[model samples]
Target chain A: MKSSRGLRLGTTLFSFTNEFHARQYSTEQLILKVAELGLGPGLEIVGFQSFRDYPEISDKFAEDLKELLSSCKLEPSCLAINADINIGKDRTLTVDELVVYHEAQIRAAAKLGFPVARCQFAAGPEVIRRLVPLAERLNVKLGLEIHAPEAVDSPLVLSYREMYVKVNSPYLGFIPDFGASAKALPPSFLAHFRKEGVPEKIVCVAEEVWATAEGNFGARLSEYHRRARQTGAAEADIHKLNMLFAMLSKQKPSAWIEIMPQVVHVHGKFYEFDKDGNEAAISYAELLPVFRDGGYKGFISSEWEGTAFTDDNGFEAVQAHHALCRRILARA
Target chain B: MLQTKLIAENGLRATSTGFDVEVRLPWYRGLPLSTVEIGDVVLNGEAINPASVSIEVNGKTRLPGDLATLYDERWYVLDSAMLHVSHSELKRGEQYDVAVSVNLRPPYIPGLTWAVKDAKRLTANS
Candidate 1:
């Protein structure tokens, strides 16, 4: 099963957010560590969140950043940008205003040497349509992230696929976060809830409800509420159960094949990498093959998210994830 | 995502006229005080005047009435400053819905702002 398409491994700076915020590691240290660990050459960064003075970098700063990446042997993969509709408490940005805000980020991404700019879920089709022209002119692709709770068949996702098909432009596409393809609830999440005093029975009931629930999100949520009430769940516990619906999706890995062509970037979202160099929850063993077989030539950025749930070192977790991905891809 | 850290327990202390709370820079990197603006402060559904707020950072207290420069550091700390808010009403031991509205003007792109409107629970101290 030799592949013809390029499938380069990458790491998103977000994986190290906790470390960065804790002052344990700087962006330069993270980039150098990525290179030092041989964790692929590609790098994805959250524009404003990662840089010290993002959305405001001077030419000198931009040049210095590019040189830093070059010296560390890392290539810019994508810039994750925010599409904030609410700029104030009582004020929401108009569609026109949103276009301006997104365009500024797009320009910044291009200036920072990234080929793609990853937009959040809030960047609807209309906003993306408005951004397409600017993206094309700047030669940077705009990828709408398909994160958890957002199934591949979700209306918003479908709408973006339709728009992409109609426009048939490379400037607009999707960045599929592997969290949507999770097979089971991440153990770290369940542990977190348990530590917070959520009873194990209640957690099990929530997992069962999630696994067997059907129909639209609203209907499924109502069913979960009903089930929780039947179990005599407390008000606070019921509320915690509701959060499960927002964190995990029931989509199979095969579902991605339908929209594989539009996937310009990949967020290899994982919670824990076990001693065997395998993810404890997500079935990467099942998902990476689909991407490999689908001929996904783009970068799959390792996005370790366990830092929020546990005190584990993000640097080591990301390194382990890269190893796991390499083994899977090698087998394919 | 807007990052926030609570500096003290029951961080909001009720005053005769208003309330006072302390906050640090949301991130490890220090931002220019001139580029920072505290637009509105809300407690328990009541909105406090943004004008009555003064920021204390780096041992120098300055009221950013019109974007005055303060703090020469290049990065933000966990206990950066205190926000003195003037409100006519506040009670003790009651949980208040606290929301802080802040806007940062990062230099790379002008007219593009990062606004943070996050809510946290604060028990008002008498």
Candidate 2:
């Protein structure tokens, strides 16, 4: 029997976004809760969400975080930082400015004892390529997230792959979010839309288009828009559901093997758990095997995004996700 | 969008010219004040003039129209800002149906602006 591989389970503090926003838990309390619930060994946090003045970590804050992590016995897995290209209202930041912006966060991540910093795709090849030396110097791996609407073989992803080949730095890589390879749109997603005053008929139309539309993501979205508009869906309702196209995708789970070697971290994105405790939309059964077989020896942060659509605190959902992943990995 | 939580309870307070309503940031993360657009405020079905409105956040107050230029100021996610509306008719202890709409142009997502609005009955305080 194959033993459990290097793939380990962890939780991103983002799973508690609702509780954090609702002021139910402070930052330090969230970390302690992760340990209290037996959810750690790896912890991920969005820099902007967790820190009051992010991209500029004060020495005091960094020292406090390091001490807290040591006491809780949790490892800092990744720091989710944004590349705010359009930070200025008049125009997007130039490549030089963008490079400087990312460097600060990367340095901050390094200071906080994180091995990886997950950057957004807003940093193009030029920005990424420029940051390679900094990443190498700081010993931080810059993993650009391959989120939904783009997959392992998407054209833009392909361009990044090409650039990675030329740059040939071990520090530059990918962080595959499992949401990019969803099996189906979760029923809760539709139900949440319905609860938000979106017409049931429109939600049903979105479900249908998600399952049957042929072509690229943009084409499929346009088709859904055209069809939903024809059903007399209001512009506001249509706009509400527009995010569905970007939050979930239809890529094959096996496609992950293409970039597994370069994957520095993983966002084990889940929406809900079924009666059997399996993830409702994302298939950890299929996804976990890819990482295991591909030799992805990194932290799979259990990122529960259901809080975006529901009022749940998501502690239970995250526990269920971790349990499911553990069960699956044990089988291997 | 957390519309129900956008407006705070007992958040209305009387100002010299009008009243201030406490409003929460709808997005998950804190953002620059400049990217925020205070769209419209309908008080008791009457639309408040946009030019006369200002927002107090991050320890400073600025007119809604000038928010686009205040890029350095931030609206922290946990703090609720006061939307100061210059209306003369709001009376202390009176309850009014107030509707507020705010839009955020996330700097990362080009050409897309996310909007959130909430309508709640709030009692004005002196």
Candidate 3:
């Protein structure tokens, strides 16, 4: 039965990073592939990766993109923008300079017909506050990506929330990456390390540490290092293990309820699917209901990051993820 | 790290001064040149002098060490920076072992620098 939920499915081209870097598909071709594969009625793109001259869209490019999307029957979900506050080698970008940088990209996003521009938090609430007027004028929402290593109540996000309350603008919000609420480290991620010669004993210990270890990230890092060293793990392997802490989040899924109203978009982050077609790392079973219950009427961009660890083309991974979401939402 | 994809396929070519091997940014997004640090270039088990190695991208060329302050130049994700070694030992149609390392310090991700290394054996083209 078709569910009446406002949630919609889509794909971000970041999922095809491997194919794009391998020169197998151009930006246009990837968009077409997403349409052909039934991966989207909604599409998202990272500006720098998809455009030759980002933050500066030509009239020709804009017209062509609009036509392409019209013909392909796809909606421009969000434009992922970079807030390069540290572009300078010797000094970080000042708030005014950062605003200028972000303004150009936000204008480009508006021109290209993206309703939302996914932003980074490198720039503080001051920079975001400075951009709010432009965002309101252009009707483009700036959604800060709450990726791994950060959660809804994280200090930085909490600061943004404080600002949001004072401002009270619908244009300012969060884009939660489900990876930040993962239930386990991706199995493929661990398997890749093992294949690289990390000992099985060390892998098991790392898994245990990831699952049951308490304390803040720094304390956990020290503990994992101490334990892995006891198992004779190489320094290189231990260094690789650091990604577990950085990429996968330990935040509980229910934590998302705190900011669900401010969520303008969702990064449906997934690494691998088990034989039963469930995500191996993140618990979509636990995440989807939060959005459903919280009245999130936005696009959930299926972001497959499996290509980061494996050579898979990721087409099937996105397909599987979409299927899983549909199955879960059918019962939501 | 996508280290294997760091070296472009069949990208070794003999230049007027020496030979140029095409090296790519392993990251998914384009970054300013200021953030990229080009490291060692070794051939046939002999490491080239660091001063003799230069990277050419976006129509401009700079020595490996000079890239640290070049904030204006950008390395497109799809593009490759040519590692030009000013040596006369390379010959056309000869297979040689090539190794390259590059470090990326993304400004947003504080206190993290991703190191990528690749070694490929390919015949040089004149």
Could you give the candidate ranking by TM-score, starting with the highest?
2, 3, 1
Residue-wise lDDT of candidate 2 within B11-119, one digit each (tens)?
8888889889899887888888778888889889989889778888878788887788766677878899998888895788889998889888877676678778889
> Which pairs of residues clash in candidate 2, taking residues 3 or more apart in a chain or in different chains?
none
Per-model TM-score on C-alpha atoms:
0.77, 0.96, 0.96
**Among all candidates shown, the one with the greatest DockQ:** 3
Model 1, A1-332: lDDT tens digits are 14425778889888876677665677778788778887758899887556766666789988988999898888999998876554433345678888887888898998999999998766678888888889999999998888867888888688888888888898887888888887777777888879868877778877887778877567777877887778786977777656567656768999999888888999999988556778877899999889888878889899987754566677788888887887777773
Q: Show where candidate 2 strays beyond 4 Å.
A: none
Q: What pairs collide in candidate 1?
A: A55-B108, A55-B109, A56-B107, A56-B108, A57-B108, B18-B87, B29-B75, B29-B76, B30-B75, B30-B76
Model 2, A132-243: lDDT tens per residue? 9989999999999999989888898999999999989999889999999898898888888887799988888888898789677899899999999998978888878878
Model 3's DockQ score: 0.65
Q: Cα deviation of A193 in candidate 3 (Å)? A: 1.8
Candidate 2: what lDDT? Answer: 0.87
Q: How many times do residue backbones clash in model 3?
A: 0
For model 1, the stretches where C-alpha displacement exceeds 4 angstroms are A1-5, B1-5, B8-126
Q: TM-score for model 1? A: 0.77
